[model samples]
Target: MTKTFKTLDDFLGTHFIYTYDNGWEYEWYAKNDHTVDYRIHGGMVAGRWVKDQEANIVMLTEGIYKVAWTEPTGTDVALDFLPNENKVNGTIFFPKWVQDHPEITVTFQNDHIDLMEASREKYATYPKLVVPEFAHITYTGDAGQNNEDVIAEAPYKGLPDDIRNGQYFDQNYHRINK
Candidate 1:
């Protein structure tokens, strides 16, 4: 069946399998394993414990775009990576379909991922790629196929309960807003 994801949350929840970003977990342990400067494995952004990377502390997943090594310290490093010289040349990725369809654009930023589908909002087919770090989730099967099933199969089955209550993806697996 063709998928219809209205938001990024819906997309990630249904299509992408996500974990705690093991690299970040190692980093968190390295920084706080046995020291006074101990912090949790996940970093806090906007009061949420989002995943991180080696030099970055945020990993956001949208429909077709995924980003790692994002800095969360209010620094301009992320800005430096953005396109300043050319609007048409600043994007990090241009899937083969997007390249042929110039009007469609999906921009992945530190906080959110935005997809502008030109005039084909409902019909655009998003990329079906999964980040290696988070590939345990499965979106298939019959009656038992729910969020719980996906989470249980995840590498880290014990994610904080609060994380599930807020603006999480839906069964359809897409997020519409931040």
Candidate 2:
């Protein structure tokens, strides 16, 4: 059977990177509506891992997409992509005992640097395409520490002002200790 979802349609074939106010940077690739390939640049729970999860994408409105997924560690992540508005709204539900402390969660806004963007209209429409296999990520034993120079040259200097100045619906979000 063929299935076409507006949410998924809006996200396919896009790549971008964003950094949280708290210094967390992530790169995301829209492999399909059902999943996203993501890599954590660094932060509280830094890692040199690329992970893809079965994600749910929904178009909340024109040019606004909501993507959510649960990680293997049982942490839940929900994010709103407002590319037209140049910002993202998200919350991370940290699994207990995994973060090395008693802290639990955080919600934040950040600006995105769009690496590539494409529309479903540009490609032939498909009801449902055969999804790809699980991803494989390779890493060298000493790459993490040895890559400090490259990390310092990361594209982000700080959270962009547009994101810092954007209005948010979730005003109840507060910064918590990690």
Candidate 3:
């Protein structure tokens, strides 16, 4: 079963955290031919719109925006299936026909701030991939917080200094391999 969101406030109100060794990115699709791109940005919903790169699409239905942190914020966020142009405005951009059929699901993970389920439909023709239930996250948090910090902060800031010289995504990136 999937969770349904009636408003944007309900979406952003949900809380989950992302665990990434190198802070990866993802692409999402809905019943319509709409797509969204996201990147792991620390302390904020990290990612971009798949259709247009310049457009900084933040939230889906509500302010249920995506956020990444080195440590868990102890806040809960929601997830939902929405049909809107990936933009900063955070408004619904769908035709009258789409209102009848929505394919987004809202899920909460023990350690994740957010996760997405690509639409799996017959006519809309979207790709379906199994979103992992357990995710490994790396972020900088209070060392005294939990036992998980060992693994999270290690790889998160493990990239070696030499490899980090040219260009990188986040300040925590530490190239472990030479």
- Taken over the whole model, the C-alpha lDDT of each candidate is 0.24, 0.44, 0.25
Tell me the number of clashing residue pairs for each predicted model. Answer: 13, 0, 28
lDDT of 3 at 171: 38
Top candidate when judged by TM-score against the true structure: 2
Which scores higher on TM-score, 2 or 3? 2
Model 2 scores what on Cα lDDT? 0.44
lDDT of 3 at 131: 28
Q: List the residue pairs that clash in candidate 2.
A: none
lDDT of 3 by residue, 54-160 (tens): 22224543533432211121212222323221211111232222222322221112222232212222223222211222233222111121122112211233232
State the lDDT of candidate 2 residue by residue for 1-178, as single tens digits: 0122244454464544566665566655555657665556546554423334578977887677888886544456788776544466777765433354311211111111121012222332233221111111111011111122112212233322222343211232221111
Off by over 4 Å in 1: 1-3, 6-17, 20-63, 72-132, 135-159, 163-178
Model 2 residue 76 distance off true place after TM-score fit, in angstroms? 0.3
**Which whole-number lDDT from 0 to 100 does residue 103 have in model 1?**
29
**How large is the C-alpha RMSD of every model relative to the true structure?**
19.2, 18.3, 17.1
Error of 3 at 23 (Å): 7.6
